[model samples]
Structures are given as C-alpha cells and as structure tokens.
Target chain A: MSVLVVIECANGEVKKSSLEAATYGSKVAQQMGTTATAIAIGDISEENLKHLGAQGIKKVLFDNDARLKNFVNLAYVKVIAAAAQKEDSKVIILSNTNIGAAIGSRLAVRLEASLATNVVALPEISGSTFKVKRGVYSGKAFAEVNLTSDRKIIAVKKNTIEVGHEAGEASVENFSASLTDADFAAAPKEVIQQTGDILLPEADIVVSGGRGLKGPENWHLVEDLAKALGAATACSKPVADVDWRPHHEHVGQTGITVSPNLYIAIGISGAIQHLAGVNSSKVIVVINKDPEAPFFKAADYGIVGDAFEVVPKLIEAAKQLH
Target chain B: MKILVCISNVPDTTTKITFTPDNKQFNTAGVQFVINPYDEYALTRAIELKEAQGGTVTVLNVGEADTEANIRKALAIGADDAIRVNAKPTDAFFVATQIANIAKQENYDLILMGKESVDYNGFQVHGMVAEMLGIPSITPGVKLDVNGNTATVQREIEGGHEIIDAQLPIVVSAQQPMCEPRIPNMRGIMTARTKPLKVVEPTGSATKTEIDAFSLPPQKTGVKMISPENAGELITLLRNEAKVI
Candidate 1:
C-alpha cells in the first residue's frame, strides 16, 4: 500500500506547510516500509513538484486542469479521491491548514479512511492498529488516538514538525483525471491573498499586539520586531476591531487560529478568545506592562515591563542572532 | 426545515491527556468526557434555527453507550430527537462513515457539525460526510441563515470570511460565531429525559490507525530576568545565551 500526501500550492510554489506535510508523510512511509506519493493541487508547476524531492518525496502527481487551480470543494475532493484510488494509498497526509482541513476531511469520507487532524507526531503502529498523538484543548494537552481502519488520513499541524531535507531527484508526472464539469461548478469566484511579509498561519514566529502598544500609531514597535525576526505580525480581536491592526491579523476564538512554534504577545490582556487561537504554540512568551495580565497565566515565560522598551531590544537581539 | 447537528463526545477542554500503559490507546481512566466545544456551537445553532423556523432539530453522535448522556444533554439543550451510533469513533473516516450512513437514511435538509473535535481534532468529518453524500460543504461556517429550502452561510477563509448561498441538503460546520451554546435550563434538562434517543448499530469496518505512546512535552525552564532598567541586557541574554531571539 502507498502513503499519499496532499500538497497545496499557491503562486506556482508549494506552500511551506505542505512541504512539512510531505516530509512528515515521507517519514511515515519510511517507517511503514512504503513509498510516499504526493498529489498536488492548485497552480503548482512541475519544477516546483520536483523540488519537493528534498523532503524525501519519491513522486508527485500533479493535477494541472485550469479548473482545479482555484479552491473548489467538490473539484478538489474529486481530484484527491481520484489520486488516492489511482495510487491505492493506505494512508493520506496533509498539513492542518485551512485548505487541508477543508479538503482532507472530505477525502476521508469518500475513501472510508480513518482521519486525525492537528496530529503532532508520528503514528504508533503496533500489530495492525495505528495510533497518533494530537494537540487538544487549544494545546493545553495531548490525546493518543487509535485508528483501527486500514485507510488512515492525518492532517499535520503547521510548525509542529521540522521539515526533513535530503538530496534526491524525484519523478514528477502529469496526472489526468476523468472529472466532469459538475465538479468545477463550485469553484471560488476570486483568489485574494493578503500582501505582506508577515503571514500569521505561515509564520514560524508570530509577534502579536494587544492593548499594550497604547494606540494604532504605536504599532511600529510591533512591526519592527516582526520584521527583524522574519515572523508574522498579528493582533487580538479587540485590537483588530478597534482598528489598531487589520482584521486579517486577528488571532482569537472569532479570528484565525494559529500554532506557530514561537508566539510572542505584547500588551495583550490574553482573553480566552485570543488564547484559544494561539495557545497551541510550542513556546508562548508574554510581554506585558502589567505583570498580572491574564495571558501571563498561560505563558511559558513572561516579562513585566513596557513593550515599547522591550520590543526594540528584542529586535536588536534578533538581528544580532542572525 | 429538518436540521441534523453532529456532535462528538470528547474530554473537557481542561482534561489532562494521557495514554494507556501500552500507549496503544487513549488514557480514558481519569478523563471526564464533554460535548466537543465546537460541536456545541452546531447543536445550539441548529436548535436556534429550528426555533426560528418551527422545524425539527436532531442531534447525531457516533460513540458507545457511555456517550448517550451527551446525546441526552443535546436533547435537553433543544433538539427534538437524538441518534446514537453504537460504535467508537476510532478515526475521522470511521466516524464520518457512521454519520454518512445515518444521513443517507434521514435525508435531512441541512447538516450541521463542529469544525473539529476538542480531543482527536480530526476536523475532517464534516467535509468528509458532505462529500460522501454529494452535497455542498462549507466548513468553519460562522453564521448561517435559512429561508424555506434555501440556506446562506458565512464561512471563514484564511484572512477574512466568505458569504455563500446553497440550496437545501447542504453541510455546514459551525465554529464560534454560529451561535452561543445555550446552557440547559432545569426544565429543559427534565424534558430531555423523556425525549426519544434512538440508538443504531454502526455498519462500518473497524479502525485502522492507533496510538504508539504518549510523552509530555519537555517542561519549560524558568524565566530569567536582566533587571527592569537594563532592558538591553535582556536583548543580550536572548542573543548570546537563550539564543531564541
């Protein structure tokens, strides 16, 4: 049986999260004594698929139909189902991002496979049963899940596992599926991407602001720190709705959920909604003018001081480290 | 309008996660299960929709006999009926299969579910179920409106949100904005006891994936400080010593 990895691409390049999924799926295949086959979606090119070899992907199956370029639920699921069937895959893997969560789950239903999202580690396969550990309670804890079905699907949480790189030449092949126009009927009408260096979900290190910076104009301190760290910038929901930061960067219960390896919150009061989004981070550092900020309760480390005084120092520290 | 709300029985958000001695299964010894937080949104929203439209709300769960309490709680919250699939939710596929099997028989106009479970967090069941049934699926849907057989949904995208319109028999996975979960009033809890909870045996294969072991993340080191006035020293420490800048 084959281990199939679903890889999503944008701007003709594979997303970083998908690369990590590829690495993860390949590792799982290695442990299972199987080969890792990747199924690419969206506008990714063949050259980019070849580059995925560095992550130990042996082959990539690219669906190049123009109708498949956009994020359409029916079309994407059909494409993935077709690929999994063609490869006779026993396990399917992808990143636990918006697209992956949306598509991977539907694929599981069609394939009648066991699925686990937000999976943090490799599977524990003993005898015929497979088990995986996943983050739960917004990262407050972990749960070991057993997938007794023969077909399994896993959506790896972003930034949870390091991407493995090796030197190799992967075989990239063009895949043609017998999909009808009905599958493409629900294609997205538009593809809009937020323009910035700081993408919250894709960021390795995220620098978030709360009520601490005092005003929107004072956001430069937060921006500078994020720039120096090459990390994404975000804000709490209140900060976003109040116009201190754009709504796109809001991370909370009603906003975007992220699990970056390192999350730094400045001046945020750490409301439950806000913590719910980022609590899954591997390391949480809180910098608040008030030592008793509620968010500090969940922080792995804390600093009781002004973010204005602390952020620039952090930027300088990051630059020096680089 | 006939609405089917899917909820998963999982440990409370505050539960400490652990594995069994062999690490091949979840350590359920001290775990107190609760309705998945996300699914609560779905169940409540479905109830609210039914209240507004004078339709019926049905709560569906796939689990063993122990999870029937949660199904009853959902009924107490406002559902007209509850369906319990007699099986363990070993994986997303197996769970989705059970739901799809029930859906095939119900022919409901709208299917509602959580974005993901609090425990396994598969996040795939709703989409998978929708696909299996060949219906429109909008995941992480925050807001929903129903008019006759037409439904409009607001689904969260990466940076913003999208407004979508689809006909009846669609699948929508509810997140926070769907609705605030209603606490069961004393009267509702009492009425829930008599509501019909039909249990159905699952028609699916056994699970495939299993757990290997559980290991807690390394405990973090204590905080180190460079005096408040010497803020720059903290930078030096991060750069030279901590090396995590």
Candidate 2:
C-alpha cells in the first residue's frame, strides 16, 4: 500500500547515499500511485528529518532514541518494522551500506519479504511481477532479479541513482518502538570515526595511489594531488596490505568499492581485481610510468609518466584551476 | 566450540563473466570455480580457532554436486568435516533458510561466513540466518577473537570501524585482515579425501527472489592519451569536456 524508506543520519545530517535511497523510494511510490514515508532512527533533528520532503518523502518518522544513534541491529530493525506495520508498507528501500545490509537482511527474515541488495536500477513492475537490476560479479555484470514475496525490500547501491529535489516539505512525526535492554545487547562497545576531510564512498572525486608510488614515504605526491582536487585519498590492495595505508582506503575487488564521478589512479597498475572495484566511476584517469599497464585500457584518459614528476605538475595544474 | 563456516563456490576473480544465450543464467562453461576469497578468511579463522581452543570446525555449502569440489577444498584447508545441501542457491533468503535449519539441528556455537559472495554480491545470508535462528549477527568483521562464551568482533562501518562483543551462538561475516587464508598442504589434501562429506536434501523449496537475466557493464571507449609533458592539458579536458573535475 505504501513505500517505506530508511533514512540514515549521522551527527544530525542525512547521509548522501540515504538521500539517493529516499529519491529512489519516492519514485517507486509514484509508480505505485502511493506516497513514500521515511523512518529515521537515532539522534536526528526534526528540521533535518523534515528535509526528507525535498527528496519526495511525504512523511518522516523519527525515533529519537540516544542508543539508536549508534547502530544496534536488533533495535533498528524493530523500529523500522514498527513503522512499516503502521504505514502498511509493501516495499522498503534503503541504501546498500554496512548498516543497511545488516538491517535489511534481518528485516527481510523478520517481515518475510523478498530481499535484494546492490540494486542499481528501479523495479520493472508488470502486473504481479517486480524485477530489479543489481550489480553482480563484483561489478563486472548485472542481474535482473524478480522479488516474489508480497513484501519487498531493496538496498540501493551508492552513487547509482540521482537524488531528487522537490518543493514540498515532509511532516515529521514522533515514532516509538518501545525497545528494551535486550535489543541493545549487540551494541558497539567502541566506535572509531575515520579522521579525514572526505570519505571515499561519499566523495565526488577520488585520488588513489598504488604500489607504483614505491613507498609510503612518497605518498605525499598522492595526497598533494588529492588535496589540490579536494578529493578523497585511496590506494590499491597491495599498499593496504603492506601497512602503507589503512584497509578502509583500499579500493579493489576485496576492498571498498567506489563509484565517484572522477577517479584518478597514480602509480597503480590496473589489475583486474582493482578495476572490478573502481570500474563504475564516471571518468577514470591513469598515471603510470608503464605505458603498457593494463589500467590504461580501462581509463578514460592516460598520461604515461613517472608519478614523482607527473603528480606534482598535475597538483599544480589542479591548484591553478581554483 | 562447534564452529560452522559457510563457503560458496564462485568463478575465479579473473574469470571473464558471461551469461547464457537467454541471459537468464550464468555460463559456467570452461570457468574454473574456487572457494570465494572472502569465505577463505572465515574458513582460516575458524581453523585457527579450532586449533587453539580444541574444537570442531565444519564447512557448509548450499549448492549442488558441482560445488562439492570446493567443499572438499575447504576440508582440505582444515575443516573437520563438510556438509553440502544439494540445491542450487536460488536466492539469499532460501540459502539462509537452509543454513538456519541445519544450524538449528546441529546447534553451532559460532557461525562464520563471508561478508558477501563475490558472484551475486548479496550481503544477506549471515543476517538472515542469525535472525532465523534468533541470534545476533555481526557483519564484515575485520577482526574477531573469542574468549569462552563471548566474542569480540571488529566490524567496518562507513567512515571507520566498530568493535562489539556478543555472546555465543552469534553469526559473524568475515572481511579481509581477519586472517590469512590458508592453502591446503599435501598432507591435508590427502586427509581431505577421507573426511566425512555429508550431502543432504535441501529442507526448503521456497525462494523469495528469482533471476531474470544477466548483462555485462558498458565497455569504455579507447583511452585518450595525453602527453606527459602537457599533463595540465588533461586537467583542462577533465574540467571542460568531461565536466567531472
């Protein structure tokens, strides 16, 4: 009857990927001739929840529980289920994030809904059938999946759908799930937030380095270029493996997958696994001393040169643009 | 401790993905299958725990006969035994149901698996199975250590990571940096041949989702080669032509 969207907020601001989920949910609601309702967990301002209307949500449900601010899987699932029951929601939409994956799968079992994750496109509904396209094979291929259950859950991949801005404002309502102590059992004992100007998954432009940078000492070239471009810094798996960078910054098949607007690879050979992680970027620039590097084939632009000489010039040129 | 580690057989990471003519199923012809890289972490960690704590590690897979080879490989890597539910993993829900049913019968103290299968990339099984069995699930755990009945798991979040502690009977999905996946030695491989491999009929037939088709991603046109001397020109083109800078 209705579409429910899970809007994730941190420090009182909605995450960029959740905004896209809101937009995708609203569009699905429109196609179903119903309105989209959003259920937000944790500590978020009412003003910020109301802003969900800009993404086509008509109603925003907020459970202002302090414990929910950090992700407690059971508690979050119970609250979202309560909202879905209240709204008679037939479809649930969420971003395919770490929290979303934990919540969506459990929610699917709890609600007996058909579940799909890593979905990249809208559902094609024909009569009783609802099919969605999702990225499979580590971004190498796509799979069109049909949700057979009456209730459906979709986890949208980041940077795949465009967020919409509409004129209307959503009405914020207080929602209470009456969670208990048992729900918080698996809550995190400690949360460590990465100290960086830009997060790789949310950044529009990403500057990544690889083993070609030679050593961690020369990482300043990659960082300088990233700083000049105002982009997030990433590296290949080998760099992360050798303790040159944190695993969070590694973008490859087994690492974090990024789909930024622009991805600049410095000194990184384009390995198949690495390409699998970043091939979704809109524009790819490869800078490597080996002109025959396989990465050049997948890149949109290539400048064959040594990173020691080329990165500084690129940084200077990027700075001049400002 | 009775640890159950689930593994999936998938195409080699470098395998060229292709679909059948109708595009409804993956073309497995001539493609070599390996134990999913992520699941290797879980298997190795379980083996390490078994060795240190003196417990049994069982490797489980929800697949047909074709997947038995990879299941044997997991046993070769040091699982005490292996279980194969004879069914094609149609969807995450169905697979979870099968796993939950077996876990309910066996009563595993710890359940381990990959964060997601590289083939389908469905990060759902661990949570779903945990929910089905009425237990806690921690996912993409980069680090895990167990002391008595309690498990301390470090899981990845958006910007960073979180460390959480849960009681026994918890499901944990492994990510990288958890442990170095082990390769089977000749002695282990010989023992794996005699290891008890149990194949049971799938307990459930209901699947929540169905695959309709498969397609490859759009190919990139040729790369625009820029002179290393005119590196700045690349920036101009990115700003003007690509409009993505």
In model 2, what are the clashing residue pairs, if there are any? none
- Estimate, for each residue in B111-207, the C-alpha lDDT of model 2 and write its tens digit: 9999999999999999999999989999989999999999999999888889999989899999989998899999999999999999999985999
Candidate 1 per-residue lDDT, tens place, B72-131, comes to 889889999999988888666678778888899889999998888766555777887888
* Cα lDDT tens digits for candidate 2, A107-168: 99999999999998899998999999999999899999999999999999888788898898
Worst 10 residues of 1 chain B by lDDT: B218-227
Model 2 residue runs over 4 Å out of place are: none
iRMSD, all candidates:
3.5, 0.8
RMSD of each: 4.0, 1.1
- Reported per model, the fraction of native interface contacts reproduced equals 0.37, 0.85
Distance from true position, residue B13, model 1, in Å? 2.8
